[model samples]
Target: MSVSIDISGLSHERIHVVPSPLAELGMALHALSEPGHHPGLQGWATAVSTRLDPCLADRLCEADFLWRSTFSDVFAPFAGLPGQSTLPGATLAEELDQLDKLTDEQFVDAALEFTCQSTYSEPDRNLLADPAVQRRALDLAAARGPQQVKFTQRLLDEPPVVRAWLRKLLEDCDEAFFADTWARLSHQLAADARLKTDLLRRKGLAEALKALSGAVSLDESEQLITVDKITTGRTTTGSGGLVLVPTSLGWPHVMVLHRKGWQACITYPISAPGLTAPPTVEQLTRRMAALAHPVRMRLCRHLARGSYTTSELADAHGMTAPEISRHLSVLKKADLITTRRRGRYVQHQLDISVVSRLGSDFIEGVLR
Candidate 1:
């Protein structure tokens, strides 16, 4: 549920605040591939999709395995590809240049390792050298999905071909849309990094880590910085220490890469300018209307206590399951609630933050 970064005996100098173009590009690609998750960029994503060349789109489709997965270290310079050294590059060209230095064996190894992360629990890079191991890895990849299996096969059988294809795809993406997008966002990204650096200097690591994102927390007593994540792991910040990369497009998702032989890196979403603008009148109206009903208001009060399944809510409220589900749907549409699966039940809970912000959002909407 959390990633604990041990910072015992680590100097402040080891913790860096750097802006990465490749990491931003990786996030952009992810935003492009899964537009629904990034509601803020829906307009931009739609425009980019319309302008994309058919051939380039096909190539992007082929490489969905890389961007679709949350573990996109292949595009990050700090978490360099397997057998490759880490480099904090300022520009995309510099990052790609670092990637270009990878040998055929290293490229294949990196792809294999990335695939293994999505499929197997324990990934042994040493075994990747064995042809039998590669075959088994391919089988595991097959179980994940078609895109993963195809990419893995190409990576293993045609390393050079895949390497060239990947390079070209990145280049084409830059030319198509990412170049302009980065140009517009780079200033904000750099400013965020500078702000983080200043915070680290003035407030110390505890405050600085806490300011990274809502999902991050610091425990001074334990000397650990814990990140709220689905998969849990712990890594000690050794001599390499920690690198914090600020990304604009990586909103709502904080990714931490702490693999062996690399400095632990956390790529977090920056408080993007203009991106987190106040809600519109329509949004405020919808949210207000969602809680205006007597039944829904009572439901919100109950959900504020804890999460409940539709059946549980129905039982508690003395209502049918269908009636509870309809009200829950209205709240969900208004972004007043969130849901998660717990075994066979789908538990729904009030989005307290959204509810709490309604008053300010309504005032801002009316005034604006």
Candidate 2:
């Protein structure tokens, strides 16, 4: 199965155009940047709590904080939490200490116990492999795909379904849609609850939702709505009521980009037994995979610093234009990077913003 979110070998720029549905799911799963207002998680939390083992669920929560910190500190600008740094030069022992001192033995034992049980969780096993499950997930994907694609086309294309949904949500001070959304997402969550839980936990679902809700509420309280273009992952918007975009694979919930940040919640759909895995190298050619090469990695690093034409990239790396073009071609095919045509030049730049959001979220959280 071709995983929509797969960009393993793609350049960062091309990765931006990742199917909006997949990107939306990715964003929603990690949209836990707020609390009660965390429509995404709250929508699916009940399902998660129901399907996932209590101990595993708790461990997942702990792991979320760990990964969120890791991504936020490593990536910088895209930090999801915002203002947070990776766990500073502290050892595992220290980490246990800062929170509540635990003996090295206790921490190690706890870690092993968590790793063992969660492996068998449903989502980890790939829910889409089951034909029935896959069909249901695909159905939801089909239902929402056209709408999401339309929304992605441009600001004006925002679908009525989304607009109406948002209007209802915004008018209801308590965000009643959250409950319905969660219930709707429950089917998918149940089918892939184990996997969804793992990914959400890994993405720091609990913390991100908490942080996001706080940001949205505070933004609303201060009337901080409407900012310049909001850019997340590779998607950018000028101005519009945020809409929760759905993924073809069916997500645990829905997520929408608001002027300030985001609004999200769990969405239950009928459990589909099968959906393909996230994108992978096996899905791309060896040439396309070259984007993950060392030379390519460095080139991306440079371009991410600032846009540079092919010639400039070659000169900086002491390589020929042809060589740079070869690398750029591979990167472009993988959707990891993109080139914009200037008056007299085409410039290249990195495109992996999904991971960057994780980084951004962390920074925001820690800084505050």
Which candidate number would show the highest TM-score if scored against the true structure?
1
C-alpha lDDT values of all predictions: 0.74, 0.33
In terms of lDDT, the poorest run of 10 residues in model 2 is 68-77
Candidate 1's TM-score reads 0.71
- The reply for model 2, stretches above 4 Å from the true place, is 1-277, 280-288, 354-368
lDDT of 2 by residue, 41-117 (tens): 45454553455545544544433421211111111112112222112111222221222232222222122211111
Per-residue lDDT of candidate 1, residues 63-86 (tens digit): 765765454556664554443235
Q: TM-score of every model? A: 0.71, 0.23
Candidate 2 to truth, TM: 0.23
